[model samples]
Target chain A: MVDYFNEDITSLHDKLVRKEISVRQLVEATYDYIDKTEGKVNAFITLNKEAALKQADALDEKGVDPDNLLSGIPLGIKDNIVTKGLKTTAASHILDNFMPVYNATVMDKLDALDTITVGKTNMDEFAMGGSTETSYFGKTHNPWNLDKVPGGSSGGSAAAVAAGEVIAALGTDTGGSIRQPAAFNGIFGIKPTYGRVSRWGLMAFGSSLDQIGVMSRTIKDSALVLNAISGHDEHDGTSAAADVPDFTAALNQDIKGLKIAVPKEYMDEGVDDDVVSAIKAAIATFEKLGATVEEVTLPYTKYAVPAYYIIASSEASSNLQRYDGIRYGFRAKDVNSLKSVYVRSRSEGFGDEVKRRIMLGSFSLSAGYYDAYFKKAAQVRTLVKRDFDQLFEKYDLVLGPTAPTSAFGLGEKITDPVTMYLNDILTIPANLAGIPAASVPAGFSKDGLPIGVQLMAKALDEATIFKAADAFERHTDFHNQVPAFKGGQN
Target chain B: MISKEQVTHVADLARLEFDEAQLNNFTTQLDKIVDFVDQLNEVDTTGIEPTTHVTSAVNVFRDDVPQKGEGRAALLKNVPEERDGLIRVPAIIDKEED
Candidate 1:
């Protein structure tokens, strides 16, 4: 029996190409592996067994195609992304049975490359919260410790990859949704520049900041997935006109004389002492790799959390208004009037965190307060962008801890939304700036929770992010560590 | 701190109907969150422009030619109430002024 669980994308792809393993065999292994771990992990909201098998049989008969980057590898996507004929819930009760009739642009790209969709992973309701605890489907526990949260709203995708449920996965980052969870789970994830990937089929949480990205076990795997899914799409007006590069070529690039700016403010306050040390160790490793690391100030760092919440929630409040009971999704059974249909359906359908965000967002964007709140946050967002832009002219990348701390206990911060919001303090700035950033597993804390170091580069500079990440990963064994949850079972 | 009335008004604007308990909960949470973001007021904007999007992605127009989209049947598939391929909804007016 081939130990499919131990292989990453690159090795797995090689095995498929060499005809050493059959696609049907891999699909079966993936399902069997998912069945074994899913009870403990709770990674997927819906599994695509019937469709995956049909795709797998066709692949086996047709033989592997090297040009098809995904070939036979299975993928897990966050539930918010639309999949044609597949139910996409966004881990919310409102979308509980909403099967998208059209594939999202990214989904079309993945389908073209012949990757089987293993399932849709759970997430925070409407991508509103940090911890997966806000998911209507129940929390996806961190594979490292069953008691800890897999940070969200891309939590289930991160946990899925970490637990070896899927070879690679897709996640959307609004405000650190992708990077923070990847940090918590100790895997690799990227939030490509805002316009780098199309948002055509993604159910928008924050339209301006949301960009779909890859979650995988290695930097190499992430780059390949990025290579496959990224590029301009006419379906999304915000998609970039910039040319896509062969990101895999970025692997093994020399980081000599690379200028990396480590934010001094990120290491202070809410960041834990252990997380600080892990990031510091990453800085030392960069120095050893011949890259210059210096402490620079993003002086307005304190304002990121507040600015992000206002701006993101404001946009979310407007974007989510489409879910009125009239079109699709859940409807209030007893509502006679149109107004009641809108109010009652939304009231009953949305989870608490989603409701809270909608309420705050609507209030901020409401008549008199728009200038005071929404407009003010936008101005602050300008300062945050300027800070990174100015640094990028002199530095190749900005380095920081992906989150303030490692994965916390599941029930710990659920009570305080403020603290949960604070978990994104470090990562929110990247989204605000629309820069490409990646989380590379840096080290483990004393408590055994994974910590990740973030690498951010100027807009459309995913190559440099990959270069630095590849350098850091070549030296660290953190990405190679499998959680005991899987090791014991296997 | 945000008042219950403000919360109620905002809830109405959001089209979300909540009961008394939810009103109190939302008011308390919104108060703390609003106060937290209120820190932005102290930062002087001077001559700065608000950034709605970082990419500065300009309007991308397609030709007037029509394109394929999710068809009528697909669009109506998820609707709770539908009639003859059209979405069924409550009447717009209960009683006319005239």
Candidate 2:
């Protein structure tokens, strides 16, 4: 039986406040779980035992104060988030040993709340790939089925939560990096509307598309984390100045009369039957709860992926150019000239996936072709956003499958970049429109892999997302299931 | 069609070299991708405005006032070679005498 230790964040905090368990004990239990399960999952890239324990001990010394909502809770960070004096690798060979001199804005917010970060988690090289196979370090396996991949580039964060390694972790979403992986791994993950969370200190990959996200086993816990880490930051110029609602406070609110739009375009031919059934079942549950469900069409939804690719790659080409062996990262030692050093360092440091993206980005942004490809893609992006704008006029939230299919075999789609890119089709539309989207554990496929149902909301309306996601979780038992590790009986 | 020569040229422009096998592989892969992306030509976008950012906001810039600096040493510490506190590199473009 899973112990009370496995309780969600809010309940765990309540227990802490009641003095049922000390903060030190919770921190120790988290580390114990990490030590036990990390061998099988390989979720964390760096686990700073000293720093984590110190933070936990300090929180304990401060005692249970009413002001500390997330005090003493041990958390994991995606490697892309910069933490002072820790290696912020983004799971790339180029930055294997590069240390950050400062913390990301989100980290500072979490720090202010006294949340103890255990360490940085793994990711695809520069958060580039979907399967996590493209990580410079070895791939992170699915907690459910070891042979299958954990979805990525937030694979490590999702896997860690699913494997009970960390209660929660932070992830960054550019093109469904958080939600898709959360869906694949059978956990709750959320990508807030662009600018809802600050982007300072996150290694840039499609700067306009990137938003820091959260992953956890329960929707409420995910929302709690979101509330803690999200807010305006002057450090990040793109951050929104909108006031953050108390996500946990409004989670229990009824969705009795809320109108939901399920885009017909997302239910096209390529979508798997099992995924469709799961979403339909979720819709039925919503209808029973008194929420009105209707079909809405995002006619330009089909154009989202291509448009996302052009814009994201074009931006990435420019963002990644800063890592040309002239700054703090891996540099080729034997090269004689600066040109040779730049070329050789990048050539040797970046993995195949990273190189492919850099090449694609450069190609997309190249002279003469930008108008035909990048500019045209931008126009299509506007159309995609317009479709969402129209849909929001009639609906409270949008719901769909996070991916067309379930978690695939590790190497099945890696060789074909386009096929791999297709895994994020449904989730990318939200990013393209700069809206908030989340993937919650809906149910399992016949093969027992997890299936995810996504809830997306209009810009800066995360309260709606939390309410709907919490409502879904309250009616489902999928999040209760845990993965059996190696040598463990299921 | 993308040739090995074009691949070499692009690679040179990007400041990298690929092995023979990698060149062959990338050429084939890039050719297919370029062709697939060409499908975008079907949609006619005569007067539509290009969207540079998804959100309606514009010119998201932080204040120009300096808050903190990690120092020049940390910034230039990883340069492969430096002379007189400046990064040293081979001349890709020739310098003219005054």
Candidate 3:
């Protein structure tokens, strides 16, 4: 079997080009690895082994296209992205058996490149929680330490990539969903600037904040996939019309004189000391690499979480109203009235966190509260964006810890919704500003959990983020560390 | 400051129903969350414009063109109840007793 642990997309592509490994061999090896490790990680919601094998066989008959790096490559897709004829649940019971009749824009793009879809990975129900614990299907344990939670709602994607189940995976980030999990799993995950990628067919969470991105073991693999998925799509009005650059070309680029702003609020009280030290050490490494790093202040940082929650939940409440029982998805049994059908179906179908957000959103947007909550939050969002706007005038990037801490124990903060919401405090500002941000493996804690340093760039400047991430990745060995996978035991 | 009655009202608007235990639990949790978000009041936005979206692009229009949708058979595949290619739902109107 092919050694998935050591072989990345480029290496696998080289082998396939030389006819040393057929697509079937690569696909079979991926399933073998998944079969061995899935029970320990619980990273997938549905495994598309049969369809994937059939696609691999077809690719073998046609021969590998040496020009396509993603050709014959096995990739895990986040469950929220609709794949025609494949179960796309978004880890929510309401969508438990959903099978789309059409593919998401990204899936269509991947299909054009001949990338094999391994499966739909798990996530938080409706992408509402900080950890994958809220998934009705069950939580995805961190690959680094199974007893700990994998940061989510992209936890399964991160674990799948980290465990070498697939070459890479797709993850969506609304407020640090992609980056936080990537940090916990010690992988490279980038949440591109809003509108950089099409959102068509992605199950909506916070529509304005959601952007589909790539997660992989190496920065280059992510860049390659990002290249394929980025650019304009008429199907999604939010998609940017700007040209998609060759992100892979940004790899190994020089960063002399690059200005990086380290926000004081990010490292202040509430952030774990070890995570702070790991990020500070990473800042020093950037300085040594001819980049200029300096302390900066985002005065509105404290308000970001509040504003983000209000706005995100408000949007979610509006977006999720489409799940009424009359059309599709789960419907309640023994309902005599349409109102009862709607209420009972939703009450029975949604999980606790989803209901909480819907309630929060409905309350915020309801009569006598819009100005006090939703509108107020929208105005505060302006201030948060202004902070980034001003910083971008002088600094090319903002640096911080991806998450406040690394992979807390399962159920540690699950019961406390306030504490759970605070986990994304450091990462939410970028989403509020609609800027591109990424998490790259920085260092490890005393307990051996991986820490990641976040890099944020001006809107539509993912190339610079990629350049800095690639530079940091090349100078450090953190990304090279693999999890031991001890099966939920310390 | 959020109360159980308020929580129930919001649930009603959201078309969701909760049991007594869930209502009490949610009410307490929502109160805490509301207190947490009240921090936003600390930031004074005297005349700041609300940012509904970050992108500069607005009113993006596509050509007036007709396209095929996923066929009715495919669209109805996931519907909980259907009859004669139509999604079946509970009655919306009442009939007068004859």
Candidate 4:
């Protein structure tokens, strides 16, 4: 078995800085781990072995600045975030061989730091599903249990971090894509406020809701990675110009007297009892720390899911309109006319879940139903945002379960689209509210699968997310436990 | 309230070809989904301003700088046929299959 102590990035970085380990050694060990687990986990879609080694050799030969936060780190990136000269499929058949000519803003930022991006990870095609099962490449199974799914469309990133394939990874959350999978996989993941990270090259899902997120084994690692990637970029018009605090610097903030609100609505009705208990236990830990806790109601919380589907799908339909098989991606043969090309390419390119979304989105945005569905959902979205605003006035942050349940059996709900959609029932409200939320593993379920407790902060308040998650991680050993697959010989 | 034919029509518009069984399945599934969506009608939205974006960002117009990537001109160029910078399709407006 690989030594988890040495394998962890935090420890690896410490060792590398202390001259106990070399970048070459760290890179080789990472490759060895990936070689052992890739066949079973299939977390990565693209691993540039030669390029990785070449970079590692350069880092070893020239040496890196010891003070650099991620000087000699290896990381995974979700394929949707473009990397110049690398094939970025977003796990869709359409872009199977498409190579990006430009790096995404986040990639450029990280590249400036010289962080080694080891591979491109898997995800649901066009990021349209809750499980990586929708991936055209194939389903990515949970590392904890091969029979179960890794939550998605950021599943690959979450699983990669959980399985220790990479120190950390970047994920995009349009509607709980990052946090839900992180919750399911039992790792730390944060979807920064909508404009916290630039979306310059990410294939748009819900443009308004989508934000680049970070995933890692611990909250400190997540914050370190977030600090590197969070900032304003002129390329993304939606990028915030507001000042961003040093997330890593604020990691040790005290939780005492921090007003935490437990949304009673999230605990009642649809939440799984075991998951709720775990969250309640987590909240109790906070209370024991001298933090004030109170019950708050986001009355319109029930409407969050429907409002989310309508708005996310509507944005998806418009965003996905770009994939017509002409510019790039898979183009169908024997298409006599352009119309046939558009229809056939998309119909064949997208998976069933994606098609379902496109159709629903089209209907919602269609002329007749616009006011009835799309418009109404938007109005409710405001009410949902209002709930967060009202609650934030009284509380420093809001806490809830990331999902109603935990990592389900691989094919359990895949056949039933509604059941599959309901997986993000809890996470969707944060997306609708446009808040920054992070999922930290609370505890294990009865079946031994991981359940996540989420903390959401007001827009651009990543400091609060880090503060709460940091304090929580300091209290729990859950972040230190690696999945069974991490046993090197697996 | 959507019929099987309506589903088929929308499928055709989306250019997806489903078999009879899949069609029937999609019809039933979509009917339930549409019914679920119909619940939006229950909330009295009288005088509630419809919000398409939560941030209230409007027109979000980036400067219309000339660029070579998939643009309006490039998209119009891909349509089966175009007349004076517009997509040309069979006139479905007048041929309503009532």
Best by lDDT: 3
lDDT string, candidate 1, A1-490, tens digits: 4454578776777888888888888888899989988989999999999999999999989988976657988999999999999999999888898989999999998898888999999999988888889998988988998888899989999999998888789999999999999999989999999889989999999998898999998888899999988999988899999999989888898999999998899899878999999998999999999999999999999999899999999999999999998888999888767888888999999999998899889988988999998988999999999999899999999999999999888889988888889889999999999999999999999989899999999999999999999988998899998886632131
Q: Taking the tens digit of each residue's C-alpha lDDT, what string does model 4 give over A1-490?
A: 3343335556767787777877778778888988887887888888877787888888888777677868778899998999877779989987887777778999888888778888999999889888898888887878888777899999999888888788789999988999999999999999998888989999998887888999988787888888888887878878887887889776877889999999898898778888999999999999987788899888877777778888888888888888877666777667656666777888778887777877778788887888888989988887788778988888998999999988887778877776777777778888887789999989998877898999999988989889888888898888777677522232
Query: How would you encode candidate 1's per-residue C-alpha lDDT over B1-98 as one tens digit per residue?
Result: 79999898888889897789878888898899888888888899877899998766677898899788777888889998998888888876766311
Q: For candidate 2, what is the DockQ? A: 0.43
Instruction: Note the B-chain TM-score for every model.
Output: 0.86, 0.66, 0.92, 0.58
Worst 10 residues of 2 chain A by lDDT: A481-490
- Which ten contiguous residues of candidate 4 chain A have the minimum total lDDT? A1-10
If ranked by lDDT, best first, what sequence of candidates would result? Answer: 3, 1, 2, 4
User: The CA-based lDDT of model 2 is what?
Assistant: 0.84
Instruction: Give one digit per residue, the lDDT tens place, for model 2 in A1-490.
Output: 2242368776777777877888778877788877877878889899878878777777778786766668777788999999987778999888888888778989888988888888888888899989888888888888888878898999999998888877789999999999989998999999999999999999999987999989999877888889888888887778888999998876777889999999898878899999999999999999988899999888877678778887888788788878787757888777656677778988988888777767766777777777888998888887888888888988999999999998888789989988888788899998888999999999888788899999999999998988988888888898898875533222
Give the CA lDDT, 0 to 100, for residue A437 in model 2.
94
Q: Provide per-model DockQ scores.
A: 0.75, 0.43, 0.72, 0.23
- Stretches > 4 Å off in candidate 4: A1-8, A486-490, B56-98
User: Which pairs, if any, clash in model 2?
Assistant: none
TM-scores, each model vs. reference: 0.98, 0.94, 0.99, 0.91
When summed lDDT is taken over every stretch of 10 residues in candidate 2 chain B, the lowest stretch is B89-98
Clashing pairs in 1: none
Which stretches of candidate 1 lie above 4 Å from their native place? A2-5, A486-490, B96-98
Ranking by TM-score: 3, 1, 2, 4
Q: Highest TM-score among the candidates is held by which one?
A: 3
